[model samples]
Target chain A: MTNLTLALDAMGGDHGPHITVPATLQALRLSSFLHIILVGNEAEITPYLSQIETSVRSRIEILHTTEVVSMSDRPVHALRNRKQSSMRLAIELVRDGKADACLSAGNTGALMAMSKVLLKTLPGIDRPALVSCLPAVNKTPVYLLDLGANVSCCSETLFQFAVMGSVLCEAVDKNPSPKVALLNVGIEEIKGNDQVQQAGQLLQQSPQLNYVGFIEGNDLFSGNVDVIVCDGFVGNITLKTSEGIARLLVHQLEKGLQQGFFVRLMAKLIAPRINSVLNQMNPDHYNGASLIGLRGIVVKSHGSADESAYLQAINLAVTEAQRRLPQMIEERLESILLDINS
Target chain B: MTNLTLALDAMGGDHGPHITVPATLQALRLSSFLHIILVGNEAEITPYLSQIETSVRSRIEILHTTEVVSMSDRPVHALRNRKQSSMRLAIELVRDGKADACLSAGNTGALMAMSKVLLKTLPGIDRPALVSCLPAVNKTPVYLLDLGANVSCCSETLFQFAVMGSVLCEAVDKNPSPKVALLNVGIEEIKGNDQVQQAGQLLQQSPQLNYVGFIEGNDLFSGNVDVIVCDGFVGNITLKTSEGIARLLVHQLEKGLQQGFFVRLMAKLIAPRINSVLNQMNPDHYNGASLIGLRGIVVKSHGSADESAYLQAINLAVTEAQRRLPQMIEERLESILLDINS
Candidate 1:
């Protein structure tokens, strides 16, 4: 494996450098073959960098940027004006081939728009999708794609997502033939809107992909399929909705535990086991969402991610970079498109 | 407070007469003014009726219908051909004014189609919507609408849903000036597709509705809004996604509790309290999604609902009947439309 370099957007996310700097340092210690370029204000990032030893610090380089993309900054406005922003600069590093991948816990829309403008989509791919691994019942997690990247998608774009998702799943998960499904309201034929219906038809006829047909929202966690494809509008809602329900249930359980003395005692005894299990299933732990179909790798971490979660995002970027995901997608897509065209 | 009569599809749902009969008896026992017309084959429904005494059985009438709408039956096919089916007959009873409302745990699409064709929409309503109560942090449950009733809803249809949802929430939940929100990918003014964006603008302009702007999927259970409106496609996915996540979490928690001896013992000790708390928040307990905007009240229960859940659906039917939801919507829509037009 070659040495992989990741550009970290140090001034991204709600906690900014406070979370990103520590996560970067932790990531550096974990990966011997990994180098990180911290992109943010020099003074703010320098304080966190000073404590590390000179040899370890040798792998870490600070690429200072004066501007930071605020979470609320509109994507178009940011793209037009904030070129030197840490998020854009980090993506620029990937575009300029200075870094194998870029990691940011930042504004998803801005990052996506900037990455699209700079890195560009691979040949035969109309739009890049934000793909992430979701915890499922099976040992291997399920991949769900286009998570708020494109709010609306036509049939061709959705088809492209299905192909890209399959390639990524097969490469990353090491599954030879990954089963892919389109996310719809119902699993039955003649279900879903025009876009989904047409996409289903396209997926069904694809010889190069293992298309398993439609899956309902309830079946998402069943792990019945390796890749679940949808437009950004639905995918984003599904992801966020899952997070909401998980939080609500956990909150309810904690409240229930506080009511009675014996119950509270029982809860205390079982808390460790429960937390371990829950923390594994927690969406917060699932850190990075890859901006797939792009010419270069760009990993977007949750803007609200903590140090541990941000580190997980950095780890994900390293893994994708090591695997050469974009190249694999580019290779697989050529055959898939040839089959479709034929 | 007049005697409320409901038509139940006895042969509908997974368990058929087994669940419906007991749930019917229990409902009759609880409500002194309630009368039920169990519509199904005489042979199938009579066996259950024989066990009950004459006094309770007097409130129950068996309307023999040889045909039954199977779960997988297509909506249009069932509506066109299975007019004599138990599900269709139950809905027909409401249209004929033989029953005040109808309850079915049969095919949702079939029920919606039949209800729309027979009972018809209110004077000003373009289409009907499926509205259900979802558990939230607040004392009152959140009302989410258009749950797969209209797969693709125009802005006008969405605007109508907002008005209808507000009326239904006010009438049934008894909450004055209920806060309404449109479900979208993001809360920002610029965040959604054309349909949702236009709907938001329409909602914001409506003086009759207490529009609270856009809400993401994660906030569906926040209890901050009384009514959440979306196209049937998005709403159906959101509701099912929540169900899927809830089931996954509960399954994981149970599996976790079964691990070690000490943990298992603690689980047993705290199981009762835990179950009680979980039960209150459980989506299964929240039965009976009302098909609103129609001239009659029709509540669709989960096809897999048990006796208790089935009874909850019947109770919902009685409540909607008592409140006269259609009448309220009709009155409210007239005023709302007047405001919009002026």
Candidate 2:
């Protein structure tokens, strides 16, 4: 029941509104005052809207558009060329302040390209980096920045990401001066190339962070630290890899349970326990990643998101906007970029 | 008994000989022909060997080496200084033709560094890569090269890895022309950097390779391709992240199965099934990464390897030696490098 209204990409995602619509209803049931802006062709969202008409019928607002950003759409061409696309228009609502944030279960590259140009990176913010909220041993998530936004990064950009990631932890998890680590081959001080090595030193020097030394890829989920900083290329691979492996493990478990009647019975007996375990490790629990240091909030869902994933994103956006993290980051890092310029 | 003996670094790995010893014994029990050249101090190995006074023990040679390479030891410094070190001595066996291949569950950096300087990269190979055999949906591992060897890579190096990986796949799996893929963030033909894009073009243009187009991180386990190529930095991150997430998955599963008496009973009933599933996805199965395209056979195991992991390394080295993969790769890629160089 917050003041923020979220634009949900209704026609987007692999499952479209089937999962998205149901997940939306679930979020509405959880919230008292969330005004939803459903952005897709009216005909497509109308049926699902009618289905969830009880809890959200009065609170919801529809922003109809016909253009669909296919998974394989040319990113730059899609944003510029597909002018009236749902993904683009939905983001425009955020730009126009008609909605606080735009959540999409659509093509990632398109969303990033569109959001960056629309919401724009905040002052002194190099780019709108994608942060990944990874489930850690603690109830809190491990915030990893630049998860495939800027593939190529300099030492300074990575350093900036560390700062942004730390601030994000503060905003979302109520952690101030969150522990930060640069992704590297080794945990030692002298590990990695000039970029990561220099970034390591810079994060350490930046008093705004609780800079721990380099963390390897294996340390990401080990509850070793709070924030992990990396270039988009490495981050993307890490995020997708973790997700894919988790999926594989589940698949392997299912395959095991199907081998015999004994295993099937065992699975049935422990189904509740298994469900609780999955609930804890569920990707949805740590779903939304805020585009930290953006002039405005932009939360990207998994390109294959169901309604649950989109709902997580909306909550993330609302949280980020409430914190006003962009202003804080600008205030802190303004001197560095300007000092370099001067 | 097998005609070939393999040198094993007894002091290496997290679980030491407890796991390593059992795993080695497992491999020995399975393989009627493995003569393990136990490389460690006489005092350290004598007790273990004395317990195994079978006929096979007579064939086992205990090489009493004075020095053991600490995981923290500088690679080049250790190789140049510690001539009597276990890892160094292990490689020396391959150099002196005492063992067909050498496997070590010691410091990875030390192994690779020592291996490269001692064993040397194949002619035209700029650097030797630590290629991990990634478990795919196809039930076989896809060879991923440069998994944290040389971080920054040029086009020539990636192309060389593609050749080296293909050769390894052929020799190890007996697949003549393995599907080669360059790991990029996207799946388009022109999706990556100048280096990857150029390599992708070259891979396509080359008649020798079964060159597939670019693959994203998700495709690694998708069974869409056989070999994945990348710079060491990205490869290392991918490998480590995959392991980290896999470990998390096991922990979650174990915790969930132990929630209550009912759950525990179910878990006990399904213990055999779970173990079978775990055995299939066991990291030990893909334990050893051959420093492919090197002049001599050098296998690198994880620094924290268990007995099963070490044993797997021993088995891998034996198989590579049996197939003469290094020799085959040298013959195949040597001319290609020369072609590129010329």
Candidate 3:
């Protein structure tokens, strides 16, 4: 197979090129059939480019741009003024067929806006949903969608998210028929608002998807469903709350271990085991979030992600590029439309 | 001060009289000026009543009824058929002014429904939100409301929740002017749905509330705000997600500690510290959920709560009863309404 190219927004996030460049090099070392185009200012990229090993420098390219998107820039403002920004240029590479996929740790709203306007949504997709894989109790990853893309979604939009989320699990996780569930306050059909109830009905009626009815927030880690769908408002709150609770527990555990001499000595003795558990619960391990339903693949990494975390984002983009995710979603959507029409 | 009386639905929870009776006895021992009316089947309450010490038995009285509300019963069904149920009768005690407050471990939906119909809402309050206190990093409990009452709330309804939640912290937590925040996906005013954005504006405009603008789910435990107000769907999901993640981390920690011989031995040595941390994070310690914004005080305990947890619920009820919470909220609401009218 030929090497897949990924466009990295090197001038994005807090540390910008300093973090992205090193993460790209690390990803390149691990994956032989991978190439990265670092997009940022020429001066900033040159220093990082020089640090890469001469032997492996051939696989690393630089796409220099003068403009940059600030963290506080609004979506509308960024779209209007950041035409030549590094984030925009990286996304443009995918639109112009120069790169297989685009990965950014920049402003999420701006990235989504630029990606939508540049690559456009798939043929049958009205809006792109922010989807991500979360670690679950079943030792498998569960796909949750509309994290913060469309805060208030209608029934049709939610149904579209479910379809896209299901396809993501099937294409990426090899789950032929992923069970999709709607996140609600209760499992009963009578629960939630009109939008969720209508969406649940549509999901149940869909012949192509495995709809498993309604589920609550606790079900996210229950490992009972493959795809959990909800409006962006609820989805974002659930995701962030899970992240916050995870951090709180780790902080409390460390505090507990530092109480006295006896506990401190015991903590040192079992440090390796405790560290392993913490590593598995680390949010950095699951850094990348997929901007699904777009014309081309785009993965958003956390702004504070370190080397390993950023590398995971690049690897996620590579995997999606190799799977031809956009084409697969388009095909699936076309068949569903045909089924409804017929 | 006069002894405050509380109505206890002894047959409500999973363990029935087994957990409720013991919990009531413990609460009686703790509060000398507290009286409880245990409502349940006579046959089931008699054996537990006999087990109680003769001295404390005077403060614990039984109100026997044959009907009971099951956990699986729907709210509408429980309201329509279980009219004479122990849960309903307990709420009736409060309605008739025989008991200062009511504490039940029955179905949440049923409890809310019956309480709404029996106790009704305070004047100027459109809807009664489900309010509860969550442990925060500041070692103080932050009051959050609309847990699962009104699923789809408009802008005005959200503002009402802010008012109710703020008053809850003031009356319960004794914060003179609590800082109130609207739970949103982002801190920016332009973020979240139309409802949340409009609610933020309304909350900011209200001179009665010390509105602190928008807060995300991560801020729930940050202990930065005194009260967090959100629609029922988002609030319920956030609370449950936090609970789920807490359980997941504890499970992971225990599993990690038991893996090796050295780690297991070390775990035993530091078990006391670990237990203390776990106990602080235990949901059982914060078991009671207050049904705020009603004309009377009604506390809902988890159906699966054990003896200690049930005792906490009874104690919470006792505290609220002595505080005259309903009258305090009424006065605050009336003053706010006067401010609006004047």
Best by lDDT: 1
Candidate 2 wrong stretches, greater than 4 Å: A7-11, A15-33, A38-68, A135-138, A282-286, A332-342, B10-36, B51-58, B62-64, B135-138, B284-286, B334-342
Fnat scores for every prediction: 0.89, 0.69, 0.75
Q: Stretches of candidate 3 above 4 Å error?
A: A135-138, A337-342, B135-138, B340-342
Cα RMSD for candidates in order: 1.5, 3.5, 1.9
Top-DockQ structure, candidate number: 1
**Candidates 2 and 3, the one with greater lDDT:** 3
* Candidate 1 lDDT over residue span B1-342, tens digit each: 588899999988999999999999999999889999999988887877776877788899999889999878889999889979999899889999999999999988899999999999998899999999875445678999989989899998998999999999899889889999999889889898999999888887789889999999888888889999999998898888888877777778888899989889889989998787667666776788999999999999999999998998998898889988899999999998889889
Q: Kindly list the interface RMSD, in angstroms, of each predicted candidate in the order they appear.
A: 1.4, 1.6, 1.3
Each model's lDDT? 0.89, 0.77, 0.86
TM-score of chain A of each: 0.97, 0.89, 0.97
- Model 3 interface CAPRI class: medium
Q: Which stretches of candidate 1 lie over 4 Å from their true place?
A: A136-138, B136-138
DockQ by candidate, in order: 0.78, 0.62, 0.72
Candidate 3: tens digits of C-alpha lDDT, residues B25-58: 8888887888889988989988877666766998
For candidate 2, give the lDDT of residue B221.
87
Q: Least lDDT summed over 10 consecutive residues: which range in candidate 2 chain B?
A: B277-286
Per-residue lDDT for A123-241 in model 1, tens only? 99989999998754456889999899999899999999999999998888899999999999888887889999999999988988999999998889887899999999989988998
* Model 2 deviation from native, Cα RMSD in Å: 3.5
